[model samples]
Target chain A: MKIGILGSGNMGSSLGLLWAEQGHEVFFGGRTTEKGRAVAALAEQGTQGGTNDEAARFGDVLLYTIRGINPAEVLTSVEVLSGKIIIDCNNFEIPEGFAYAPIELSLAEKLASQVPNARVVKAFNTMAQEVFELAPSPLKDYQVSVFVCADDAQARQTVMKLAEDIGFTAVDCGELRHSRLVEGLGNFIRFMIIGQLQNPYTTLSIDVLPAASEQRLGGRQP
Target chain B: MKIGILGSGNMGSSLGLLWAEQGHEVFFGGRTTEKGRAVAALAEQGTQGGTNDEAARFGDVLLYTIRGINPAEVLTSVEVLSGKIIIDCNNFEIPEGFAYAPIELSLAEKLASQVPNARVVKAFNTMAQEVFELAPSPLKDYQVSVFVCADDAQARQTVMKLAEDIGFTAVDCGELRHSRLVEGLGNFIRFMIIGQLQNPYTTLSIDVLPAASEQRLGGRQP
Candidate 1:
């Protein structure tokens, strides 16, 4: 599957490496062809790079990793993003790291409205750069959860496979409205972790207790 | 010390019963003298019930369990909460069953402002009513956790011990501003539990890993 990464920042590059390592065709969407090429060259062999618009057209799915607020411009800057599975890994946190409640419309909502016909799913917004670096699943030889929320069932299935393929346990957290809870949890941690307190190592473990029976999710870690 | 609980609801009654059980002079504050006496009669032996003003004056510490939006009116109706340790358990969420965010002043800040000289500490704002009723402590008894946030150290310590005496594990979550995260977590769970994805019986147990080599706060479970 061709996976396109929007925004060639640290997160976009990390995802590109992960996907390319898994043998999927990974594309980096950058403002310029040269920037996109730089990110692609950083990926494993067979990975390709292109301009933001070219990446959108080239991939089967497009992932949004830009700042939570930056997608508004990036979506419009690119000519079209309709009918593509857009995974939102962005959050609308104000500058200076103050998590003052959430915004009027979540980033996913705005993206869905702005990019008409785009199948948007909220995932991977709650994890840190290191957690992505350490993606867990049966694919990765462990099980860490990746929560997926979307209105489209097929779109959710597509996202789930990609998540599992990339090596993380995928749990569908119901429809898109649940993104409010996702963003709220993220915001709470953003302040709690970034704001700095005791046990500031990795903020929190995204893994849930595996119901005592499921060995993969949880079993005698303590 | 005489302890007062305004708004004789389940929460108020729960705390009052437990605290009175622990030998604190607990008073259930109701609207009128007769109403207070009726509830008091239903309470454990030696537990007192009185009018709102009388209860507020009867106790050295007052715990306000009134509605979130009208904290000022609620406390003012109590008549004499000034210069007392009034524990706040309020968060400003809309009554229409939606996630409400406070833009102007947070509920903790508002409660502090409402009771000018009263030393207001935020506690019992993180757990569900059921969790509070069970009363878990770090010592291995049914230990329910209640995060505490306050500006005054002595006042916070005082509340922390009171929380322990009533079978709760009070984690000092920094100052009052940090109460925002606990409030958001509590609100998030309030909806999440009803949503059924999360196991309501799942409790977050804060323990020191053996590597950390920390002893239990409540000592040990039975």
Candidate 2:
């Protein structure tokens, strides 16, 4: 997959490097070419870096990692995003220690509306960028769940496969509207890790244990 | 500890039975005495059942599990909830398949304002009631996380201890305002289990795995 990262921040740099290491063609894009070039220089050989527009035009799949700004301002700079698989990892700013979603739509949903033709999938927004920097396969003993939500099923699966490629459990969280829930879960995780646990490296996973009936009928026919 | 259950629904009955079995004086309160009586009849000996007001008056800790209706309507029926630990397990109605919190406050936070003297703690709203029925110690291999949030430190600890007594891993999520995140997580879990997995028995947990540095420093000092 030719992957484009729309930000030179922690999230974009970390994910771009990981994907590049996994043999995916990665392009790191930033507000300035020099910033993207700096991150790209740290990644694997043959990886490219350029302006946001150049990176948007470079890849079939774009990882929207730009934070603390309205996505439309950055997205409008690009010429064409039609039919591209956009994995939205952006979150609303928590200026006052509380994450507030837009009244009716989540960040991802709003992004989808901006690029109407692009397939917007919400993922990689739930965990810290440090998790990506940890290793190719970070939680060796357990699986860190990456909740993926998109109206486009194929794009959702593609992004899920990419997440699995990096060794994270990808949970299919249904349509784009459900991004509101995923975004909320992201806030919940942020508070849990930074506020309560006081640890940035910590991650969350959904552990589905065997049902009582399943346990009861362990040796018997259903 | 005396415990009062404000609703005789699935959540109310399951938690009430669990607490009653734990040797706490349990009271099942419902819209009608008969409704509460029916559930209490299924519990251990000495467990009582009556109207909402009687149950509110009976227990030092009250579990508010009423759904669909405004909590203000039900809570107003009770005479006094001063200084009592009120574990709010109610969630907003997801009528159109999305859980919507109030514009300015979460359901739990709103509950706190309605009865200012009551120490409102949010817990048990994130999982299905069947988890309690699975056994006193369900998910034996894995610790199912019960996220607890409250403004009162003592009340928070009390709820956390109660959750632990039922074999759950209680996570102190800090103040009651953070209940917005927990409630959102509840909605996320609901959609994942029912809408995505098509299983009511599934549960979620926050598994904070070893950080990269911890893994790197295996058997050595940090």
Candidate 3:
């Protein structure tokens, strides 16, 4: 699969390298191609670096990791985004590193609205860049959940597959509207691990224990 | 410990029974005392029933589980709530059962503002009432996290202890202002488990894996 990373920051670089290692063609895009090229130079596989607009046109699947800027403004540089699977990994935070004040629509939802033609999937915004750097092997025993939410079912499935391929458990949160909750979970995680616990290595996962009836049934359906 | 339950709903009743079994004196309070009385009657311990105002004045620790109505209006019935540790176990949801539109202050935060003199601690709002009914023994192996947050450190610790006593792994989420994030987590869990997976038996938890350096050090500090 061709994956375009629309930022040259830690998250984009780490994910780009990881995908490159997985034999996916990765294009690292940046405001200036220098940083993207430097990141791409580290990869031995089918990886390259270019301008954001070039990267946007290069891949069917795009990892939108740019922060601070309005996504609509950024996407305007690209000619078309229709039918493209845009995996949004952006979380809005204030200067204090906490989440921005609650808004009516989440960042992902806003991005979707901005680029109505694009199949927007919200994923990978919950964890830090360091998490992507230490993916799959180091945390194989523990299930690190990557929540994926999208209005398009197929896009959601595609992004979930990408997450699973990277050795993380992907939770399907359903619908673009549900991005608000996912973004909230992202902020909650940041507040707990970074703000409260002072632990950067931590991540959140779900533990679904069997019901009493399920236990009594001994694997049999009720 | 004298624990006052300010509602006769499933959450209030379940927690009231749990605390009662843990040897705490519990006062189950409701709009009308009949439901509270019936729930309290199920416990063969130092437990009783009363009206909301009576319960508010009865215990050193109070469980604020009343929903729908504004907290200020409910607390008005009581003469005073100064210095009392209030465990806020309420999550605001619309009639459709999804979380209410995102607001500036969380329900717990709003409650804290309403009762300025009370020591407000947010906890037990993330899980379903049935989870409390299951208790510690059934979920002994799983580390089900109960996120506790309060502006007052002592109140936070008190709530954490109560959560631990009930056999949950209590996570200290620092200040009460972070309640917004916790509430967001509650909504995320609901959307994923009930709305998406259609599984009422599931819950979310944190899985903090060791860092690469920690793994390499083999119990030695760097």
Best candidate (score: DockQ):
3
For candidate 3 chain B, the 10 contiguous residues with the lowest summed lDDT are B213-222
| lDDT digits (tens) for residues B81-134 of candidate 1 | 656888888755533445455334457767787667788888876544554434
What is the Å distance of residue A133 in model 1 from its true position?
4.5
The digit string of per-residue lDDT tens for model 1 on A1-222 reads: 888988878778877778788788888889888999998987547777877777888777888887645445665454466677888878666446463653455677776776667889987765555445444322243344566778888888888888887766676666776666667556655554455443321232222223323334222221
TM-score, structure 1 vs. true: 0.72
**Reference contact recovery of candidate 2:** 0.50
For each candidate in turn, the interface RMSD (Å) is 12.2, 5.1, 5.2
By descending DockQ, how would the candidates be arranged? 3, 2, 1
Off by over 4 Å in 3: A70-77, A95-99, A216-222, B44-46, B70-77, B95-99, B216-222
Q: Where does the lowest 10-residue lDDT sum fall in candidate 2 chain A?
A: A213-222
Give the TM-scores of the predictions, in the order they appear: 0.72, 0.90, 0.90
Select the stronger candidate by TM-score from 1 and 2: 2
Clashing residue pairs for model 3: none
TM-score of 2: 0.90
Residue B83 Cα positional deviation in candidate 3, in Å, after optimal superposition:
1.7
Docking class of 2: acceptable
Which docking class does model 3 fall in? acceptable
Error at B142, model 2, angstroms? 2.2
Listed per model in order, the count of residue pairs whose N, CA or C atoms clash below 3 Å is 11, 0, 0
In model 2, pairs of residues that clash are none
